[model samples]
Target chain A: MESRALGTGLNLLAFSPAILIYVYTFPYFYANINLAVLVLIAVLPVVKLLVPKRYSSSVYPVALIIAMLLVIATLFYLINPSRYYYLEIFSIPLALSTFFAIDFAFAFIFIFEGLLSKRSSRMIGYLFLSLGTMLYELSIIAAMHEFSLTFMNALSLVFSLEILSYYELFVYGYQKFLPMANFQIQINQELLVLFIISTIAIVFSIYLRENGHQRERLGDLAYSLFAGSIMGTLLFAVYDYFSYTQYQLSIIGFGVLATFVAISRTSRKEKNRKPKIK
Target chain B: MIRKTGYIVLGIIAGGLLESLFIGYDYYIVALMILFFVAASDIISFNTGLSRSIRNVEVRREIESNSARKFQMRPIRIFFTNRTRKTVYFHYYDTLSDVFNTEGDFQGYIILKPGEQTKREYSIASIAIGKYKVGPVIIYAEDPMKLCISSYTAPVIDEMIVSPALSDIYTQRSERLSNMKFTYGIHYSQKIGQGYNFYGIRPYNESDDTKYIAWSRYGILNGEDIYIKQMEEERQIDVFFVVDYGIGMNQGTRQKRMYDFVIATVMNASYSIVKNHDGVGYIINSSKYDYFIPAKKSQEPIRKFEQTISEIRPNGDFSIFQTFSRIKRDVKKNALVFVITPFSYPESFRKGTRKEFETNKKVSLFILDPYDFMEKRKDDVYSALMKNSGLKHYRYLTALSKFFNSIGIKSSVSREKDLLYRIMAAYRYGKLTNEGA
Candidate 1:
């Protein structure tokens, strides 16, 4: 029972950065309405966690799809929130559910990978999942600075959780004793690294703005929140590097080559993989 | 077919078109970059995966024996080799004949690398006789993320036959019979014959041979009547087994019937009589074919016997008498005839035995009860909850037995436990008591 509580706590911790960034998008949403939407966003996931997967898995996906469709409809119709307050409120969860949907997909992979327990096959599964999941973030790009930061947050968390959970280290009591070939599992100091990386990024972004990179009223608060969401989402590639020693040689994949590879997003050729059996 | 990844990609394209139409060119660049990423990573992997079809996976199935004893466990091994240079992951299921009960797994998931070989092994046993066709393995090769699928069925089936097992029952019984144990029914009474093995002395009768009179006992008796020396006959017992098969005896099946027990019983008896130098042969009366082997002493007839009984011939007979009369010429004059039938038509049995008796041929009847083999029992010796049909068969057979007694033909209804014992004993008594005549 206590382990179950710890597992849920870690889960909440895992989702916190996206929540902070999502709630940040809506400081302009009006105070009482912002509070109402925040409660709704926060409470829905908690309710999902409390309910059984048989009930919750179907409910969340259906709700997420409907919200996504409605938000798209609002965009096409130009639903002016001053005229239609409900449409405005609906858009709030839509922004946050972008995080919800991607996280939900990973949740499936985490559980399924453990059951399958074959590393190369899992890598094969994740290769497609990571590539497919990135499309949602790319599709949501709205020319807003907030969307850019939120996109980074979602992508980072997807890969980070992928790294942490792949080795069976994410679940509270689960162990990685199952026989798998060519699977390199390393210790992850992610929360610590995420804290340091976010601190450095916030200061760096502030310095860039001071040096006149700023074209908008992007303040210290926005930079800090965006940095926090970044820690929540992207370039934990250092964390990624440290966590998988075999992938460390790809550090030679740093600088121009690494940038090209990450930006171009090509498939990596891994050698001497263990044969997978079901 | 559109894979899961394909659906996600299409959804992205739709979102890209809508966002570019409504919002601006700002997020358009990001969507393009992501789209380019998807095209690069996925299409390359997808193309390579699609090229390696599941047909390239070779499967070989092996069983140690072409024939297994009934209810004996046999191990089966299946080796899977990837003939293609590419690694392939697939789910395989080896379909087994329903008569078999698998002792371990026969189906699971596995991945084979280029030129890699792996084998899965399991054991299965059948409480049945005759041939079992075990496999034509079904395989589905799935791409890494289950993004694409291909299936192939390997035509890898093999057949194994199961025949009834005859243990050392014959060896033990034949040895004891040769030692002259008077083991017919429960009667332990000894019989006198003309051969050389000495038996106890008996009072001389008018028919006693004068050369066999006991002189020492006569001297001791002095003025008393003469006594004669009796001897145990060492002659081969000629036994002919008439095994009934047809709708009357059993519904057609190779095993799990009273007929299978009768086959086992006859095989045991024939083998025992052969060990004792007795001439033994059988006639299987099926619907369209009558498998007949003439009485002979050596094991040469046993091989033919095995081959005949191994086949699933549908037995045909108008009556037990027809089977008896059909092969009566092959039956030795003094051969004790053993007829094994379910006696479904009791009148047919009565008529059959009456015809044989008129010809002055001594015969033994074994009325098989199909109910004894069909019912499941918790305790070893007792019958299970007796069904009404079973009761009717039992009552009818019991009445028929009494009628056989009235007509002077000695017979017993077959029960599984005592059936072999009874046949062995009847052959012994028939040989001991009738060898001289």
Candidate 2:
């Protein structure tokens, strides 16, 4: 019973930042959805307390499914705005869905990291989940504005790819450190690409010179970075060609770099790793 | 501690720089202010020492150890009180030892108002017999934003002992042996008197009761006999359980050990003897410690005997012979001494039994078969080597048993799985043989 309460509290802590961000940046969106999210959050703990102890474990998954359904419905509503006649009532569901989607995402990430992982710390998990959610929201907003018929359609295509690729990146990052955030103020895309290529060259030369003795750490990092940069460049070039935009290419490049780093880091086996203290 | 909100603020500052350089918007300051407020609130909360205030607060834990049963769920309660003026988010986790099988619900979190007290309850069960420590409650405190998280370890720990489950041998044996005469207690004298059982006829004496005179026997003897009827006497028996707490006794898997089986057997026997209105005692010998409880009748002694056994660990360095030699002088003449051991050291065991026999003390050795108690591993080279070693040990145990039989000493080998049944059968056999003699 105590553990259940702790899990719930930690999940709430993870979800709060996302909700606060939504309310502050998008008040109009927040106004529509605040009631539903608040009620669900408040009622969840009460429902856990009121239910028979035998059925307590069922609460989390059930709440998660409900929140997912709300998000899906809101996405559908956003896709077709002209179909609903009762704008006020339709707006409520739309707001509620959007709120739950972001909230549930953070909560699930925290649960996965803290309870199910080999290590118990949730700090890395929180970082990736937060960044992923932010990127996802940014993609949605970018797609909402119709720059042109062809450009808008291309943005949607990129958004779908970002969802799949970034979600995978988040999962990988939760397991191990990917070193994606170098804290560079100005992201230089051409310079990053050149560095990745040069690093791959140097790593290949070292591998040949050392007979693959350093394959576990340095070799894996170089190969993954090289592969990820090429993929990111291809994706950004395709999107830019259709949408006629070049400014957002750096963001896409960074996202791809992070993804590949995560993939490479997760693939290597960590021998004699210590269990993380909570 | 700054969390993802800090990242958003940094992103906004970068976005503002980009907007000024390229697509300038007049109301960018409004967006910046909103992000700034969110980040500032988190930073302020962290800098204000919210976590420190929570650590300074006191916590108390309470649980009932006696109510816990072997292989049964028992509930434990913990209480946390917040004396600070600030409202705090608190999480507490109570660590459980491997001896218990429990669900992952022994921790909780709560937002306590100032001076608020809360009690949390969790359930746990003992899956094996042994003593366990459940404690050092880990406490975590943070503000609502979770910007600054601090943890404190409360040095409070509690110990719980799970005794083995008692068997029904006591009640069953007492009923079966009600007709037999037990000549161990002071209450019933063996001499014919006012006891229930009829002994035989004897010539009437001055002290003989008139009511006990067998008129029929006297008539059959043509009045020259003048005999009185004698009856068997009932008496209390003193039972001493001599336990060997050696390292070898600790053999076997984590779920079941030879020492565990030995403790269970001794506890069951003690319960049966004490239940039958007899005095019970114990002689526990370990490497660093030795405990001796003289045989005494009553409920308090039985409880103490169980408590002591539950806390005992296997650490004996001295051989069985040395342990017995030290406690041999304390054994009463007519008292029934039960030596419960795995007989890991055969030579020491033989020597100890011989010494006890020489002293004329009625001793029975209940040997736990170590081979049977050992863990059966999966098919591997290590397991095969262990199997070969076990076979050799079994051969030695057989030889020891035969030696005891030839020397006219009572002994029995009990498997770990059927320890209780074997102990009961041995006790019944011993009673039957003593009665027959």
Candidate 3:
């Protein structure tokens, strides 16, 4: 049994490179929709089902899908080095995707670096700030209609990507550093409405490509979108209500004020009595 | 509020930089909208946050029962209120008992306008036993544009208890075993009568019976005194102890002390059984967690058994019959079985719960009641009612002991700490009775 297990291990070692090569090439042979769906299905199963239960719990499957995108992006660069100057801007998408794909690694590394008092990721945050600027700049000067449309769509996609990064920063900063400041912020209804509206626009633009029909029927999807928005917004409202209302304002305020007046009164009494003591 | 405004300005600056890179001269509109959104959202969130801070927010956690042991899941309820005029928004993040080793992700927002209350309910999977501290509910809120996020951690603490596994270990009728000598020989009759070993005999006194005499010694002593070798016959006896590591045991700031006390009792009992050279074993039945090691002597197999005991963490779900069936396979010989558990779950810890406990074999059963000893004894009327309930449960245990005794199984009951003292009391009484005889 031991020998057979060892042989199987060796076989897996030999086949790993073959599997990597197939993963890189397979997506190219298929259309983007088919490729994306296929990658999603395959990656989800391998990470979720085939792996041991404990390891599966620790490793988020989202990271693998992101990694696959990074591999594809790297392969694209390798295949077309001559077009590097024209396509250098596309690297922003690749860089952001890599961060998403390897989030577990990034989380661990950040935790370690934070322990060591190194602020390298803060620098990366600044770099993302810079690249986001550059992408916005490129979106305007694109000469063709298709080019501008693609650029605008891509920028919107980047906006959605910022959700995870910002959320991570908020949690990390709140947990480690700004603990005393009571940093719980509630989600507002207006923000939820905005998110739903923006999501609908992106979905209609990407999925429902009938330009005139989509433009005319965009309002149809608004109510359901708003309904979805309220679910999260409602939870945020309660938290905000409790934190600000309960102890911080009324009870605490009156208590402090009463204490202050009493202290001042006692001090005045003491002053009046000081001559008698002398 | 100022911090929020600064972030909004920074966001606008970022948008402008993007605008310059993309539309160059014509990128002003998008930059302006992003700036406007950030500024408006921050202002709204800051004012709302400040206003809501003045209102009363009530957070609560409701467990199914204050007293529960391993294998039982606890339900948590959170209530949020907005007592102020302006509407408030917030998100809830719950942390569970440490045994779970993972934080639950339940981030969602609620909007509570003034004089309105919102509630959320979630069930947490209970994995381990001990006193579990339930909540200091943390709420995260941020301005609408995601510029500034604030989180307020609650300052409330709640606790729950998880019980331990029970073993069905009943010993047969035996002498009272005690550590010290007693004036009254209550336990002497039980152990004084017999054993398999032969000791040196003494000359027959006036009370010596003619039945226990040696003819040759009678002849050598000229019929004045007869001597016979004293022989001891072995008589099998049963004992029982029931241990509970239930939720009530899970009170107090430190959970380890309760758990340690229960474990120490089991170990000491097992050690006594081995030293006594009797067929001794114990049963650990708990409603909170499933762990049962049958009574067995200390030897090679017991090393593995000890390892199993060491590895057990307090858990809340247990099946007694299933555990018995598993432990049955390990015991091949006729030996005593001692039960140590908190009989909490009615369905699981009742009379029909374990077939092994009812088996018509030469097994002795003992139950050590942990709850009776560990749970806080209250003096109020409600506490008096609870105490009465405890007493009723004790009567039930004693009745169960009588049933086992009728079936040729020696059964006894004691608090965890008094187990060794009881055994020692029994042994001492037996010795004095033998000397008198």
Model 3 scores what on Cα lDDT? 0.42
Report clash pairs, candidate 2: A2-B107, A3-B107, B185-B235, B185-B236, B287-B315, B287-B316
Query: lDDT order of candidates, best first?
Result: 1, 2, 3
Q: How well is candidate 1 docked (DockQ)?
A: 0.02
Candidate 1 deviant stretches above 4 angstroms? A1-278, B1-52, B68-76, B98-106, B122-129, B141-151, B163-235, B245-260, B307-322, B329-334, B343-361, B375-389, B399-411, B432-437
Which candidate would rank higher by TM-score, 2 or 3? 2
How many angstroms is residue A158 displaced in model 2 relative to the true structure, after the best TM-score fit? 35
Query: How do the residues B1-437 of candidate 1 rate in per-residue lDDT, one tens digit apiece?
Result: 33454344434433433332122122222232233233222333433453244567889888887677767889989999998877666789988766677886599877677999999998887655555677778786433223334556777877777676645224434455543333333222244577676887888999888999988888566578789888875555567787776756544233466655666667776766676667877777755667778878887777677666655533455475566566556565677888787766655455434556443456778877767666465764445345666888888887777777667777887777888878877777776576313
State the C-alpha lDDT per candidate. 0.53, 0.53, 0.42
Residue A4 of model 1, lDDT score: 33
Candidate RMSDs in Å, in order, are: 17.5, 19.4, 23.4
Candidate 1 CAPRI category: incorrect
Clashing pairs in 1: A153-A233, A156-A233, A156-A234, B286-B315, B286-B316, B287-B314, B287-B315, B287-B316
Q: Write the per-residue lDDT of candidate 2 for residues B242-325, one digit (tens) a residue.
A: 787777677877677777667666665665656656677888776765888888776566567667767756776646556557
Cα error, candidate 1, residue A124 (Å): 25
Ranking of all predicted structures according to TM-score, beginning with the best and ending with the worst: 1, 2, 3
Q: What 10-residue stretch in candidate 2 chain A is worst by lDDT?
A: A174-183
Query: Per-candidate TM-score, first chain only?
Result: 0.27, 0.30, 0.19
